[model samples]
Target: MGRHVFLRIVDVVSNFDPYFQQRFDAVRRKGLSHLQKCTAAMCMLAYGISADDVDDYVRIGESTAVEALKKFVSNINTLFEGEYLRKPNENDVQRLLQMGEARDFPGMMGSIDCMHWQWKNCPKAWKGMFMSGHKGVATIILEAVASSDLWI
Candidate 1:
């Protein structure tokens, strides 16, 4: 993400939730900054890493990282639900259908696709369940339907 966009998100989230604000520990030493908390949350989201994994990079413990991520997501949803995360309305559906038809995809509202990503940290117990038979590697499948305008 661009720096401006990231900073904008950080600002909005920090304003919405005091949890993102910097605080001092019992020893009066400053705890994590807003940047650190937001970075920890963003790293887990962008990399799909476990909360524990962000500890090494973001210097946040697993539980704290998880808390930050949850609060971040909740704050974003609450703050931007109407503008950025709304369900498609009738007009949106019609527009999507029209766009699809214009591209010769009659009756299609959007294009659907799926990709498999190797699960680098797949648990040993579930490895076999997610393993691809041909490639013999554990993977997770991600699927999305996006309009021609790239709205997913």
Candidate 2:
């Protein structure tokens, strides 16, 4: 992610939960920054790194990193789900329709596409069902509908 995007996410998370906001520890003389905690969690989840491995760069204990990840996910679900992951409403549909009409595809507001995503966490037994031997990778296919501004 770009610096701006990362900071924006951090900003949202910090606002949602004070735990993700950087803090000073006057008593212990040290405190972990939210960036450290969040970076550690992102590395673990995005790269499949072990919790202990996150300590090398972030200097966060495994338990603390895990806790941060848990809290981060919980707070994201609480704060952003309403806006990013919502079913399209009537007003949204009307806008989509207008865009489609301009393109000469009246009454067609959205299109569907099927995509295959690598399933990094696919179970062993389920691999046979989802894996494509030709691609030599385990993948799950999903069909999604997208309009100009939203994915549903």
Candidate 3:
């Protein structure tokens, strides 16, 4: 992600949840900044890394990183769901259809894509079914549709 976009997300999420705000420890020293917490959360989500792995670079504790990830996802959903995570309306569908027609892909309103998401806690029985041949890890396939604007 670009710096500005990442910062914008941090700004929005921090404003939505005080948990992202910097605080003071018992010694009156400043605690982790919003960027650190958010970066830790983002690293885990984007890179499919474990919370323990986040500490190596983001300098966050495993438990705290888990908490930050939970809060970050929850707040982002609560704050932006209505605007960015909703199903498209009639107007949106029409616009996308027209755009697709212009590009010679009639009736295609958006593009669909899939990615393998690591399933860290897969059950033993299910691991065989979920395992990815190339990655050699248990995973779940996540599918998404996005318009030209990259809204998923």
* lDDT scores of the candidates, listed in order: 0.90, 0.81, 0.91
Model 3's alpha-carbon lDDT is: 0.91
Determine the C-alpha RMSD for candidate 1 after optimal superposition of all C-alphas: 3.0
Weakest ten-residue segment in model 3 by summed lDDT: 143-152
Question: Candidate 3: where is the Cα deviation over 4 Å?
Answer: 114-137, 146-152
Candidate structures ordered by TM-score, highest first: 3, 2, 1
Q: Which candidate, 1 or 3, would have the higher lDDT against the true structure?
A: 3
lDDT, model 1, position 44: 86
Candidate 2 residues 77-115, lDDT tens each? Answer: 787778775777898889889988988999998888998
- The candidate 2 region of ten consecutive residues with least summed lDDT is 21-30
Give the alpha carbon lDDT tens digit for every residue of 1-152 in model 1. Answer: 99999999999999888999999989999999999999999998888899988989989899999999999999999999987788888998999989989999888999899988887777899998998764788988888889978898
Superior by lDDT: candidate 1 or candidate 2: 1
Where model 1 places Cα greater than 4 Å from the true spot, the runs are 25-29, 48-56, 76-87, 132-134
* Residue 133, candidate 2: alpha-carbon lDDT: 67
Residue 41 shift from truth in candidate 3, angstroms: 0.4
Model 2 misplacement above 4 A: 24-26, 123-137, 149-152
Better of 1 and 3 by TM-score: 3
lDDT of 3 at 49: 86
